[model samples]
Target: MRSMHSMRIASFRVQNYKCFVDTGEIKLTPGFNVFIGRNDAGKSALMEALSLRHTHNPHRSLETVRTPTSEPPSSAPTSVAYDLSPEELRQHLTALASFFLPTGPNASASVFATFRSLLETGDRFNADWANGVVVKADLAGLGGLRRDANRYASVLNLAHPSDVQLALQNEITGSYSSYGVVLANWLRDKAYAFRAERLGLGRCAAGPDKVLSPNAQNLAAVLNVLSSSNPARYKRLVEHVRIVFPHISGITSVIVEGSSVEARVWSIPLESERSDLSVPLNQSGTGIGQVLAILYVVVTSDLPSVILIDEPQSFLHPGAVRKLLEILRSYSQHQYIITTHSPTLITLTENDQLFAVRRQEGTNVSTVALIDPNRQDDLRMSLADVGVRLGDVFGADAILWVEGKTEETCFPELLRQLTKTPLHGVQILGVDSTDELGAKNAQRVFEIYSRLAGTASLLPPAVAFILDKEQRSETEIANIERMGRGMVRWLPFRMYENYLLQSACIANLLNAEDASSGKAVSSEDVQAWMERHGGEKKYFAPREPTAYSDADWPQHVHGAKLLHDLFNEFTDARVSYDKVKHGVLLTRQLLPNPSGALSELCKILDELIRGAPSYTE
Candidate 1:
């Protein structure tokens, strides 16, 4: 019995192709591999080049191009191409030759394969050759590699190893059928791309020469065959589609006009039972069609498949993109390559699977593999100065947008004080605009937070808002009241006024005994005393005299003193701790959901008790 080796993309390399003027290599895995880059960045080109190299089909070949319609050709075909400069023709042929070049050579593109299970022949003889395929050019003749001539001779003669060189050449033999099988399966799976006109809106099936139509004109007929030949598989496919699109209550296949086979989707609406919402296969939404196509390729293809998808995020809703990523990841035990520009999709992937592709001037493409530095918080922030919201651009669990480093540096300490716990996965971000970007950007971070607030998901920490209130208690209170609800909570304090209010209350309370007792000071004296202690009474009025009592006055004084002590401890520099403390006490009462923020603040008290390094330190 022959043992089966797991199919893997041993290596993928590209050079001087399309946007890639420089050489680039992408190390792939048996599982999912992702290619990420900005628009027009050669991600799609890379996928196509890899496919072209592995499949060894000529560019503009009928096999590579999608045929949309089932109509027969109107006339006999003609191959007319003669005009070409010596250099231009040389380059073109070299490209054609590169497709057949073996791995590990100086070729425009190269791929190597090492089968998982070695074939033990009756004679124990196996093809021992150079590392798969390599590309060699006629540097002496045309100032370019001679990969085409080398591979062309090899394909012409199966057993002649001496005549054909390995440069840009892959191993070919009767025994190494797995490669061909995988390639054929991939082509068949992806062959589903068809245009509206070619859909043969009436043709049930083509002659024996053609396979399944990309636009699925023969979907009904194909189902009819499957139902008879493999009824179980057909049933399973329908069930899977229904699961992916719950709105699709059922699928009914029919041979419509022109004898074309089509699948009709039934929708379950509020007033009606399942009704036909069957959009013609050609007229369905691209997202729905793309999804169905991808799912079909992933599940039903018979060979060990390595699905390569470029811009998998296109046309997908944000939620659907996420679902697609999850599904891809789950099915990735088989090989697959997905490329995307969507940051949301990037978040669904891990750092290892991601490859950041960048193109330099002159169209030189460079790829950073192994690990993405943008995966780290600090490196991502480094890109912020250049106007890249790296956090949003890369999909972080939460984005804490601060004005600058001071807020960035102080947040962890603040959270430690509030939660009395460590801040592990929270990502601190700096954005120039919350109003321009709006709360929407910030809301994304919070959504992730809401998901993790009480759950133990692998997701990062909850994202919380910490904008400087500009010293205004009213603004801080109002903003919190507006945005705080459910699991989403904004931290109190936006402006400097919140602390000022607390300072005034504390000052008045402190002076109460001094006034009521022999040393009891009047309101005027209290305001004057605060002025001497760095208080901003000019900007913030003290609480009314009636708002305090002798006993309550002492309590307020103690609150002010505590604030002063805590503030002094946290910041070595002098801060209006009394005012902040006084405001905190008042703000706590004003907050509809103060429990969360207050609990966080109380942890600060415990930290002080435990003698944790003060903010000043």
Candidate 2:
């Protein structure tokens, strides 16, 4: 068994394959590698190109896979080159020498030494697959070795010692007649490409073969073999299946007609007295089949394998996807190459290499940007400080930016009550302040947000900013609104706390909190407090008589300050108002009969939700 850190495919280059004209040597990590991009961005093309190195039929026509162009297909035959690490190069050379050299007179040792010497002086070794597979080496400084090759040919009993180079090439191209077939066979034993659509329902001819097929078509046969040959591993597989599907007590294979085997799941009965039911795996949900196939691959494949998965989340739920990722990570001996559009998967997987693939419109070439590991770490920490996961931002249909943490918690509840439905597709995010943008006008701030959102692929598509009107003049308010271009709006009040100034609701919240302390508050107490503080004149009066009405006084007063003073007035009681705690309580109390300000806010949100685009899988 190879060590967990054994040399794997370090990097690969693809040329003239579908959308990839020339993907210049995209690097990979030894552990987990992830590719993220939008629809039709050529992510799938890159995956297919990587899988080409392990294909069985190396002689397949290039016309079907080659990039279409005005030039002849022969001029641009599809090619994929894999760079070999030093360890891998040594392994291949060692194997080649052992297989070809005569046993006596230390012939194998001499040939291996020659190969090693060539490797030491060479710049790079690449396994290029185009018309056929060939190991290309930059042996520029090995002219003396080629001239003196007769020394190796004599021991190997070559017919023509002068043509030693030809004989060596023939030997490198294995007994399969072509190095392409040899390389393909080698990769087939070490790599597995998992495509969910290609997986068969768990049934296959019973055989002693324990190796799983690329698409897991032989899953049943593989399981049957494992059950008899390796009982411990078989038990482990059943235990893992139970973890992912709790209802499944065990997995068993039953031979039918003395020839074929079918995998079945034993479902635990709902009642203790009832016996467990055995059902064919085909009868189970597609999600379970996917999970079983994935688990079988991860659990049974040889060590140091390269597992390529395309959008596992497409077939599994978020929870199942998370569990599957955990299983994959636990098996640290294998390398993983996964492509997904699911932000949740990208956020959860701590990938060794992360690439953002993009292709311009009307172009066949695709480009990849490798996100720096340090930057990704910084992003994770920043999101953690805000109590958010990157997936949360990408999963929403639209983002509603609020002033602070208090509004972030209370706005959703208020909107849910007014609309009679939870805010399903909208995510309310709290910003430090709109003033942080340092823009003189609303349009400039919105423009900055739009530009920032444009660069961040994980951010939600539609964004709307809502903030307090503060002390802006009427003329200034009108100008801001006009310049906003529908992407920004003001609260029409000093702050969100202004809407929670209802005397009855405030008093009700206070009494509820003071119930255990043998103290109570009434609506009259709140009303009298307001009256003592100058009644409507003190709270609602405008500087100009004809400017606004007393009913609109909540818009001008400092409701947060007033609420704090009201809480201080209750010195005899044990209850006090907190902006986050009491603010939400007061908002809930006002749900039964929302104030005029809240109703208008609800109207604005409804319009925004209707216009915003909904998220799709």
Candidate 3:
């Protein structure tokens, strides 16, 4: 299933599509084009237009148009002068409407003619929409003809009404259009909008993989087909996948019952692993299913060069997200249009790749604008003079770039509760998980902050950062302070988990769920676990390998690793703990009874809600 040749969508233009009012045209780079926006701002609608393409019937187009409820049509003229038989009227209307359907030599006149073709009682159009309505199917079909009609209207604006009508008729019937041929070809063509995105991938199944749908629902069948028929493609995919899941040596799909194929990964043992180890690829981890689906599409499809993916980072960790991105970068032949809501994912991209999506003011319509990531534009330069950075130009008012998912996950809930005030325009981003390079963190902070911060204030509270302290040296801390200028912050504790260890935080979480709901760690038990782990005596939480009796250890969530393992349950269908979710749940639990453990966090959160406090105060 090797692609015939590399293809890319040069550009896409929408006329009357959803949430788009004549979004003239937008060019896309051949490599990766990132579409970033706030929720409800039309990213989904845009993908709909891209997926459906400019093909649906005229009635569909009219129905999907961005119509306001306030303004209804005054009236529609149904009768075209003389009284005629039902057959005559239907023939006449259908013919007139036929011109509206993808008019060109390649168009399908039958498609336009037959749309909502049957009238009730052989006289009425459709029994389904037969109720009282100003405009009927025939008239509704006229919507797509506006462009062609307007051309004639422009030329004959001054002519007599009868003459103008005759002229318009002459223009329509006189000029030849090859719409049917073009449309017929398009319907038969495979080269168009190609899509593979973050769609519902149910629990692992050995379902028939005969064909891969938008979400790769038939992943088993897809992999089986490729592995059997196209080994080269399969091998190529496995190699790329190995970069993310180093444990996998190769992928094998076996035919199961009912045309479904079972898929498994031949994993390399942690040490010199055995070939006998096989894991269900889908059930192995939190995001492997989606990652495999995406990679599989690239390997085994006759895809149009214009590839569309919406929220590709869903279910993937920060590290996994980076690997998926790396794969996308390698496929330079296809033009990629990707939508995302992760700060970590955004940092992986450049300014040129970023496009800001927003709703047009006071309208349901939405528009996407190119963002200058390099900060090299005239307007951006002028803003810098006033202390605004290019990065601040489009994103949220406040951004806290942290070290990893645990930090990315927990802080927002704590802050959201602590701030009390709603945070509509703030963002908490996780850049990475490791803490190897202190200097690099400082540099990235300076680079990103210079672009994202809007105010020259010592602490530009609107847009800032929070990275792990990671036991940084005094010198490193001072350097970071110089760059962050009090705006960027590092945890006073070892990591985000250290904050969770706060006595109040512990009591709050362990109490949220009682043994009745499930099982909850008790405060007394937590204290015992702490003393047992020597956490009360140690300045920082125990790292790992405690000598405490495994039997005596607290029976609830305690210890950094235990806490992580509790949250690291990615595949438990009943439970899900990720950076994005659970935080809200945790926040609700902690809010009613505030925690002193988060006091230091409160001040930083306050800076975001209300600008930095006066030092004199």
Write down the RMSD of all candidates, one decimal each: 19.8, 19.3, 25.3
Candidate 2, run of 10 with poorest lDDT? 148-157
Better of 1 and 3 by TM-score: 1
List candidate 2 stretches off by more than 4 Å: 1-4, 53-69, 75-110, 115-125, 131-184, 269-276, 348-351, 375-617
User: Scored by CA lDDT, what does every candidate get?
Assistant: 0.41, 0.60, 0.48
Candidate 3 lDDT score relative to the true structure: 0.48
What would the per-residue lDDT of candidate 1 be over residues 274-301, giving only the tens digit for each residue? 3354455456556555565556555565
- lDDT of model 3, residue 385: 27
- Each prediction's TM-score against the native? 0.43, 0.50, 0.40
Could you tell me how far off, in angstroms, the CA of residue 416 lies in candidate 3 after the best superposition?
40
Residue 281 in candidate 3, Cα distance off native in Å: 5.4
Best by TM-score: 2
**Which 10 consecutive residues of model 3 have the lowest summed lDDT?**
125-134
Q: Which candidate's lDDT is highest?
A: 2
